[model samples]
Target: MTDLAPLPLSVLDIMPVDVESTPSGVLRATLEQARYVEELGFTRYWIAEHHNSPNIASSSPTVTAAAVGGATTRLRVGTGGVMLPNHAPFVVAEQFGTLSALYPGRVDLGVGRTPPHDPGVARALRVDALALDFEQQFAELLGFLRADFPAGHPLQKVAANPPLTGKPSLWVLGSSENGARMAAHRGLPFAHAHHFSPQNSVAALRTYHREFRPSEYLSSPYSIIAAGVTVADTDEEARFRNVPAALALLKSLTGPPEPFPTPEQAAAHPWTAEEAAWRDQFLAPQVAGGPDRVRAQLADLLERTGAEELMVVSMVTDPAARRRSITGLRELFGSAPLPQGLAL
Candidate 1:
């Protein structure tokens, strides 16, 4: 086995809406998860932005970040990414700037270029899909955050309000070579969506490191690889618990998304050949097993990608099981070893 140094661990919460659970309940659960992870010594807790997805309750990560930031003392609260095409650059700066003023040194602004909605929904949101230029929008967002517009620029005098002593840390979230190059060009931190785009993770990380240039935000290249994980007392139990989330992911890809199904419901549902194949392929990169298995998988991932940080996302339907999974991961990676009875 390859000996790997312990890496910083973080959480990425999608605020999954389980069957029969209200949106408010899901949001509250997210807050509780943040607090729980903080106690377990996780470094950061990030929420994602997903519009029109019934299974995902987090549509506004900025609002969730504020709530989580206020609820916890030491945990860094941020957006896994706010899809930049959905909102105005100035609005994002002001919102995150206010968060910085309130939370001081604990806010991160992660931005991505993808639109969170379909064409019709995006039209409803009043975003011009064809005219959207991610590079321009990204540059504008940084300009607003830094208050560094050039002379005679129309918004040069318009300042993003609630300016604070220090700005929120900026990160460019990506899962592709183009996105990696963009982050490198801007000299910002990069986070790869390894959970969703495992195929591109290593290539993207390599591009980021190879093309990186020093800037005010960062003097050197820094990268995080975010992955899906679930750990239980035994490998069998962990695999059983992962079924519902795996089913949910398949549903999202195949058709109109549905709320997260219970494990029983997932097991009962009929699976077509194509769906089964897809599910297996998707599960290939995810970490799901006993403590020793999860620890080994994560260590391998860190070695392969050389990620400065590891962000784990576990979207199990059962709250208790979810908490236990996180706790198990903490124990596996932390200085402490697994309890005697639970040893692999």
Candidate 2:
């Protein structure tokens, strides 16, 4: 008989944008929830950076990671990731360098090149007028973060004071071909954004593995796939609950952000035929069903991608339900049972 493999998983704690009824309440709830999951044996807790959206409050991953790291003992805290094009290479090195120092052996640096927020916001963050070729910039940024750079060189070769002794693990996050190439060349871990860019995942990951070069950090290509999931007691209930959350997200992307609607309200609402098709093709692939469904789907996804890890992004209304979905997932993986006989 073939030995059963144990899959490692990490939670991508979304600083949810729909905290209208309780402003800053979601943030507080998320913090509390991360602690609970840590006790449940999760491998890591990574927060994402989203700007100009009412649905996601976390815009600075370094700061948020610090808050999360402070609350948990063994669970790793990191970015899902930090938008590198918006910040200077030196600044990023210094910030993450400080984080590595403070946390010491518990910090991770997952960097991405996309402009996470709106274009107007991107303009506000950029220091230069030239549009960045993220692949090249990402390559250079890698050099800055490590001590591998030669001395007496221009760019001041800031030898990472305290010398980056732990060598904070680095992962390159991406949703496209350019991103795949960069990660492969650097031999860093690659994270695919299946949650948003589902269409590009298969092609991008294949490109990464084919071109990967051996580097000091990794001898072979390693990858993590990030996806959006919603779970509940029954497949019907999961579908019922997931609609509003999905609708809220679609509205925010197409229109101005507004308060989250009740499940009934979302069900009653109408969507254009075109939008419906888009959602099915773009969003459905990333989302899976309840316990049995998610397990089978996730396992199949892993088999197809050969991903080393699965980073889950749960988008549900109530904080407890969101936590339950995560808990349900753990049980589905056969790692542990959900606390309190939770059904979802």
Candidate 3:
């Protein structure tokens, strides 16, 4: 058995919308917190892409990524991921290529297989969603970014003032066996979304490592397990904050997406059977509570997955509380790297 110190941890926040007011208010809050997350010593800060959702402030990861990269020094910024089907290979290459040129070596472009939102937005991207396979599309897209394709390939080559020479390290984000296999087969790093797909977490990790194939980019497999995390000064406080986010998610999936509720509103709505089950299933693997509890749980999950890295997401509704949750995580893990100024 290897006796090594634990792997490092990072974070991915969805750039959540504020419950208090306008979308711009939420955008401002998200940008401010992105900088704060960097100060706490996490590695990369990622934003997810969502459409037609007021609750999620980040609908355009490329734009949000630039804002995040501009605001933070030393924090690797990129999409937690950008959904591939919603965009063309060339456009993705151009957007992220420009980002890489602007902030070389500190950008990550994780690709997800899901359609951006639903049937409608999928139509809007102007692609035949059903005709293309995501895994195949991802491969082609990465090839373009690496400049491995023919000079006059149908997809136009990105002509940035200073082009990105090589591909940024790619991560395959998944919540199932197929995703694990895809990442492993390509020898790219895998990030399992235990926060939302808790039931398959262990199984997915196992499949990833077992099927891993070595390639030029990776000599061995690398995995990052992301989980919903909320930490506080006390267990009670942590649990209290956890409710609003969980309720927010449940409301969206079952009912309609609504603005985040005040702590009072969240506390008032007693959990229904389905909501309870949803919370338990989703939060089953989450690392929560005070420092001791969080540390122990995180350590255990890392040990179980044998992952090279850990990616955490704090789904709290309050900005200050969310900041605290991230700060507390770094303190618990004791792995905050110093924040250096931006390189590119």
Give all candidates' CA lDDT scores: 0.83, 0.72, 0.76
Model 1 Cα lDDT, one tens digit per residue, 8-105: 77899987887979789888888898899888777888889888888888888999999999999988888988899999999999998899888888
Q: Which stretches of candidate 2 lie over 4 Å from their true place?
A: 1-5, 127-129, 157-163, 272-279, 336-344
Pick the winner on TM-score between candidates 1 and 3.
1
TM-scores for every predicted model? 0.93, 0.88, 0.89
Could you give candidate 2's per-residue lDDT for residues 198-269 as a string of tens digits? 788878888988899988778888887888876567777767666766678677776887666766877787
Evaluate model 3: give its lDDT: 0.76
* Tens digits of per-residue lDDT for model 3, 80-119: 7888888876678778888888888888888888875567
Query: What is candidate 2's local distance difference test score?
Result: 0.72
Clash number for every model? 0, 3, 0
Q: Model 3 off-target regions past 4 Å?
A: 1-6, 150-162, 270-282, 335-344
